[model samples]
Target: MTSRENCGYSSRTIFAAWVQGNFRIAAGCFWNTLDEFESAVDESYSCEAAETYKQAARDCVAELTVKLNKAGE
Candidate 1:
């Protein structure tokens, strides 16, 4: 929720793994890029929700909370 203060960050950012291991900035994994996430989203998955695995990519700088359109803009 808050920066460590010693991390030398001027902005607030929260990084979470949520039981995921593979992490990177520009990875093909779900968390990294939307294109990659959408492309790979066709695959069948069980147990966890799609949103759970659709979080930020591993080791990225920060995530954004933008206002999306109801009609997908």
Candidate 2:
């Protein structure tokens, strides 16, 4: 049988998907940081920039928890 057919929507599949989605979010955050670094001539007043990054990180964690809980059912 194929892998999916054998596993049949197992928790492992759910966890893997969750991890993949989180990784994509992290990559986007990294790119955002790089973009800011290249464009920001002065690093002394990057409070707004830091806040955006922190929000994105929080969102990713929240999403991951939701997905994992849903998968448990």
Candidate 3:
């Protein structure tokens, strides 16, 4: 399943859309990052770009994966 967490931001939006199960068209900020990517997210959470939250989630998942792998070992 695909999930999304929206943060209050104006010009900077971490937008990405995709169908969960099979294959479908991906839109928004997912495949459309480099086109107009910028530091448009919230100023309080200032960082590089709008992909900050996304990268954070990815890093968390990666850590979980490594932990699970070690547990399985």
lDDT of each: 0.29, 0.33, 0.36
- Residue-level lDDT of model 2, residues 1-73, one tens digit each, is 0011111112111111233233222231223332343343134225665455444444544565575664344
Comparing candidate 1 with candidate 2, which one achieves the higher TM-score? 2
Model 1 steric clash pairs: 24-58, 31-57
lDDT of 3 by residue, 1-73 (tens): 1223543343333333222321221224433332222332233355544466546434433454464453343
Candidate number that wins on lDDT, 1 or 3: 3
Model 2 ranges with Cα > 4 A deviation: 1-25, 28-45, 70-73
- Which lDDT tens digits does candidate 1 get at residues 6-68? 111122232322223322223222244344543453353332533333333211223221211
Candidate whose TM-score is highest: 2
Clashes of each: 2, 0, 1
Assess every candidate by TM-score. Answer: 0.26, 0.35, 0.30
Q: Give me candidate 1's TM-score against the actual structure.
A: 0.26
RMSD of each: 12.2, 14.7, 8.3
Q: What is the lDDT for 8 in model 1? A: 12
Q: How well does candidate 2 score on lDDT at residue 12?
A: 19
